[model samples]
Target: MSLAETGISDAPLILGSHTLRSRLIVGTGKYDTLELMQQSLEASGSECVTVAVRRERLYDPTGRNLLDYIDFHRYTLLPNTAGCYNAKDAVRTAKLGREILLGLENPGADWVKLEVLADTKTLLPDPVETVLACEQLVELGFQVLCYTTDDPVIAKRLKQVGATAVMPAGSPIGSGQGILNPNNIRICLEYLKGEDPDYPVIVDAGVGTASDVAFAMELGVDGVLLNTAIAHARDPVRMAHAMRHATEAGRLAFQSGRIPRRLYASASSPEDGVIGRTRQDRTSQ
Candidate 1:
C-alpha cells in the first residue's frame, strides 16, 4: 500500500526546528553507486539522510568529502559520529561536521546522530564515553540524538544529560536482529516517556524488514533510523519503498491504539444469536 493509504496524515511531520518532509531517515552508505543512492532516497521518501565524516578517500582535489553525492538542500543531512571511540573524537568529528557541512551560520546544527563505539568489532556504544560526549554536545548547543543500548539506566542517563532523543539499537549494527531485547527497549521507552512525555525514543539499527519497523512503532517508539537493511537488500529501491510504507503504517497503528488480549474466546456475533441459546431449545427429542 502507498504511504498515504497508511493513514499517515501530513500533519505530524518529524522536524528539527525546521520541518523535514519525510519521517523516514536513511543512510548514505552501502549503495553501489551515487545514482543508486539517489534512487533509494527517492524511493524511500526519506527527508533526512545520514553521512559519516572521517578520514577517507576523496574523489576530488578537496581531500575526503561527501558533498559530491549529497545535496544538502534536498535532504536534511544528518552527519554521524559513527567511528568515534571516545568523547574527544566524537566531539571533534561533530564540530568538523558542523563546519564542513552545516557552515558557520548554522552552528546550531539542531540535530546530531551521536555514536561512540567502544569496540570496532561489535560497534556497540561505550556507555561511559557516550554519556560524556552527550553532555558535552548538549552543552555545545547541538540537539543530540544518541545511539545507545536498550538499557533503561543508560537511556535515562542520556535523557538526564539533555539528549533530545535516545536511539537504542534493536540489535548490533548491520546484524538485522530486529528488536532482540523488546522488553528492555519497552522499559527504556516507558522510563524516558514516563519521566518526560516529550522525550523522543527512536529505534536505530538492526531492523531487517517491515515487521521489524512495525514492531518498534507498536512499542511506542517515536521513529527509526536505519541504513544497512535497505542498502543491502537485493532490491534496494523496493526495500526502501517498503520501509517507507511500513514506518507510516506502524506510526498510524500506534496512534490508533490496539485492543487488549483476553484469555478466553470472545465472539463477534450478536449476543442473542443461536450460539447463545440454552439447551432447552434442543430438548424436543
Candidate 2:
C-alpha cells in the first residue's frame, strides 16, 4: 500500500500558488552525494524542495550540476536567497533563480524563498531587509516566502507586506535545538492565522529529530521545513521516513484534540462506571 493510502493526511498544503501534497518541505543541500540527496528527498514525501541560490556550488569540478540529479517534473524547486545579507542582493538572486527555472520550463519560476541574513555568525534573517526584499519580490509578481525569526511582530509585519508565506525559525538555523521557544511559535501562529486560518506558517530550521517535526505540527503550523535534521542525520533516508511519519502523526493528533493538562491526577475509569463493588465503594468515599 502507498503512504497516502494509510489515510493519515488531512488536506493538501496550499503554499503560495502551489498545492503541495506533503506538509514537509525538505532542503536540497548538505548531503554527501547527489544520489543520497535524491534518495532522502524521495523518502521525505515532500513535493517541494528548496535550494540555495547563492554560494551553493551548483556546479562541481566535473561541470556536473546538482540540478542534474533532481527530477524537475516530480519536485517543485523553491529557490532561496541563502547567502544574501542585503535586500538588493537577495532580490537579484531571486530574479536569477526565477530566470534559471523559467529557462528550464519549471513551474517554480513564480515563487522564491526570500532570506536576507542579518550576519554570518547567527544566520538569522535581517527583519528589515527581509521585509524590503519580500515587498520588492511581491511587486515583481513573485510568490515570496519570507524566512524570519520566531518573533510574532516580525511575522505579522511580513504578512502585512505581502509575503505569500512567513516561515518563522523554530530556533537558530542548524542549531539542533528543536523549537526552543514553542510559546513564541504559538503566538506566531495565533497572530498570523488570526484572520486567515489557512495561511501557511511553516516552522523552518532548528529541527533535529522526528519529534521536533511532530511538536511543531501539533502547535498548528501548516508545515515544517527542515534541512540539517534529515540531511545531516546518521542515516538521511531513515531520518526522512521518520520525519514524514512524524508530520502525519502530529497533524492527526492536533485534529484529534487532546485533553487539557491538569496538576492533579484524574481517574482513567470513573468510579460510577466501575464493575461489582464500584457503587458501594463510591458511596463509602
Candidate 3:
C-alpha cells in the first residue's frame, strides 16, 4: 500500500474560509540570507507564512523586499502587525497589508496575523488592544487571526471578538522555552474549542525545536506558527524538514490515541501468554 494508504492522509486545517493542508505556519524573517529563508520555507512544507508589514521589514537594507525572494504564488502571505503597539497602528498596518496583497492578487489579501504588542522587551500582546484591533479588523472585512497570551479567558474573549483564529503564545516570543505551562495551554484549548470544536486555535511563538511543535500539536492545537525555532536553527533547512514531519507525527499520534499515563509499568507481553508458564506458576510469582 502507498504511504498515504496507511492513514497518513488526515483532515486539512480550516481557518475561517481557508482550508489548508499544512498545519505548520512559518515566518519570513531571521534567516542568514533571503535564499536560505526561501529554501527553509520550502522545506517546511507550509502553505502560509507570516510577514511583518513594517516598511523596514518589507524592504531589506538592499532596497529589495520579500517580493523579490518569496513567490506569492507558492506561499500565501499572512501579513502581521508585528511592531504595532496599539489598536490604531495595528489596524492601519493590516489595511496597508491588505492593499499590498490585493494589488498582488494574493489569496491572503483578506486575512492577517494580528499582533499588538504591549512592549518590545516582553513582546507580549496588549490584551486590551488586541481585542480592540480584532474587533476593528473584523469590522473592516479582514479575517483576523489574533495573537494573545496563554490565558484561557483572554483566548475566549478574542474568539468572542470574531477572531478567525486565536493564537496563544507557547511562551514569550523567540524565548525558545517551549510550552511552559501545558496546563494553561490545555485550558485554552478547552475554552476555545469547547463551543466550536473545530475552531482553529494555533500555538504561536516560543518554539525552539521540532519536538516543541510536536508537543503543542499533542495538546490538540489546530496549528503552530513559528519563526525563530526554524530560522535561527544551526541547520535551518534541515530543521524546517524536521518541523514538518513533527507536525504530521504529532497529529497522527493524537488521532491514533495514546495510552493513559500511569505510575506503574505495563508489559507488552502478558505473563499468561508466556510459553511453559502455567497459570498457577505465574500466580505464585
Report how far residue 91 has shifted in candidate 3, in Å: 0.5
Clashes of each: 0, 0, 0
Q: Per-residue lDDT for 1-285 in model 2, tens only?
A: 655698655789998779987999999889999999999999999999998775555557677688899998889999999999999999999999999899888889999988899988989889999988999999999999889999999999999999989999998889889998999999999999988999999999999999999999999999999999999999999999999999988888888898899999888776565567766677786
Which regions of candidate 3 fall more than 4 Å away from where they truly are?
A: 1-7, 56-62, 273-281
* Candidate 1 residue 214 C-alpha distance from true site, Å: 0.7
Provide the lowest-lDDT 10-residue window in model 1: 10-19
lDDT of 3 by residue, 49-85 (tens): 9988765655457676778999998888999999999
| TM-score against native, each model | 0.88, 0.92, 0.94
Error of 1 at 180 (Å): 0.9
**For model 1, what is the alpha-carbon lDDT of residue 23?**
57
lDDT of 3: 0.92
Highest lDDT model number: 3
Which has the better lDDT: candidate 1, or candidate 3?
3
RMSD of each: 3.4, 2.4, 2.2
Better of 1 and 3 by TM-score: 3
